[model samples]
Target: MAKQYDVLIRLLMLGDSGVGKTSMLCKFTEEGFNSTHIPTIGIDFKMKTLMVDDKKIRIQIWDTAGQERYDTITKQYFRRAQGIMLVYDITSEISFRHISKWLDMIDEGAGSVARILVANKSDASALRIISKEEGQTFAREKNLAFVEGSAFSGDNLDEAFEGLVKIVMDRNKKDIDEQLQSIKLYGSRENSTIDAEVKPGGCCS
Candidate 1:
């Protein structure tokens, strides 16, 4: 078979328990959401291969179990992640309040990793304890990419995932470009040294 993608990216969704992390995963990957609330027992994996700006990308999403007991395992996934979505329920004040702690976790595991601040369950506008303005303010304060999403309504899911992917891809491209440029410069320097080493007799150096 022909090559399917230019890159395979690992992304993780993290937050406190009952922030609807799994629901959002199902919403984005399966285009469906589960009404019944089931706490994730362990890490779950999903993959979607698609074209982004003419580049085929296979995004491997790691859905973390949000309970405190599973946090040890969840933190392990952070190290290898290219991007992370820090999610929280709009209706839950406590969930919103814990964003700083989650960010600290991200720093400890994936330092300076690409991240998005997601105010999830936006469909719960009526019950929203954390206002959209509040979320935006916090995102600005943290200088983080931000999106308000609703897994139930399939709202802003694309924007959130795509935004994070774009950030990661851009960073990857930049890093590769720098490395290639460095190699090119090194090759030029090596050739210059070789030319200099060739004396009148062109003897081996």
Candidate 2:
């Protein structure tokens, strides 16, 4: 069978319970939203294929349960992730406050993985406790990409994934380039004939 995509990127979503991690993912991948709050029991994933820079990129987004009990299971996914979405509900101050703790966890396990701070439920303007400026300030401080949107209205929802994929792809390119440069340097040094004494038993024979 032919390969479906040129690149496979794995993304993980994390936040306190009720922060709309699953909803945000559903809106982005399925273009559907459900208002009823059903807590994810553990970790679940959804797949979406997008054409990024003319490359078929398949994104596997892993949605993790936000409850503390599931932290162990969720942390296990961090090392495998290419990007992580640290989601928080704009309407819930407690959830927003917990973003730092989530960041700490990402630092501990994900180790420089591309990350985006997502302020969800922007449609709930009446109940919004976290302002867009606040989210932007925090993101800037942490050098993280930020997006404020609502899964219900699908506003700016795609930006979260698009931005993350860009970061991941850029990092991947840099790594590949560095590897090639190192190989080129090694080849140049190896081919240099300076101070060489011919051993007749080897390739010189």
Candidate 3:
């Protein structure tokens, strides 16, 4: 732990095909998106290390195939994820409508994980079908981090990932506190038991 990063964050990407999940991921890890079209087959991931709040962190980002056929395979990765990005095309109503299905998979696979709603293809305003207000409303209802991004033009990709890590870090801290409290409680019980059998001189008199 001392030699490497202080924490590890596993972020999973999910959404319909052609929503640019792969492209968005590439933008974050590579600082550029591939212009050539190539759909993700089953699953893939990228690892990047960063220094946040003076702590070293390694973010493992996983991208899953959006096709229904690969749902079973992709769901397996949700088990240990700390953050989840639900991406959708800003220009496709069908893709936006199907966000619920992807969200359901997360619930079943990575329940209670930190969630963010990404309105991708913000650069394509002419082809846009989903309004920014509509997306923001949905995110507000669900209490999720909301951001508009464009992988091709390089927009808020960094903000989206940064927001996710902050959420995960807060949760991780809470979990650690709970565990420490439990250990203290158990130790106190053991000490009480020992005291009950001994006299006042710190001996079994």
Give the winner by lDDT. 2
Off by over 4 Å in 3: 174-205
Q: Lowest-scoring 10 consecutive residues by lDDT in candidate 2? A: 196-205
lDDT of 2 by residue, 66-156 (tens): 9999999888889988899999999899998899999999999988998999999899999888899999999999999999988889898
Model 2 C-alpha lDDT versus the unseen true structure: 0.80
Residue pairs with backbone overlap in model 2 = none
Candidate 3 lDDT tens digits, 73-136:
7877788688899999999998899988888778787889899999999999999899999999
Write candidate 1's Cα lDDT for 59-152 as tens digits.
Answer: 8887777777887887877887899999999999998989998898899989999999999988988898998999999999999989998988
Each prediction's number of clashing residue pairs: 0, 0, 0
Candidate 1: where are CA atoms >4 Å away? 175-205
Candidate 1: residue 92 lDDT (0-100): 91
Q: In lDDT terms, how accurate is model 3?
A: 0.78
Backbone steric clashes in candidate 3, count = 0
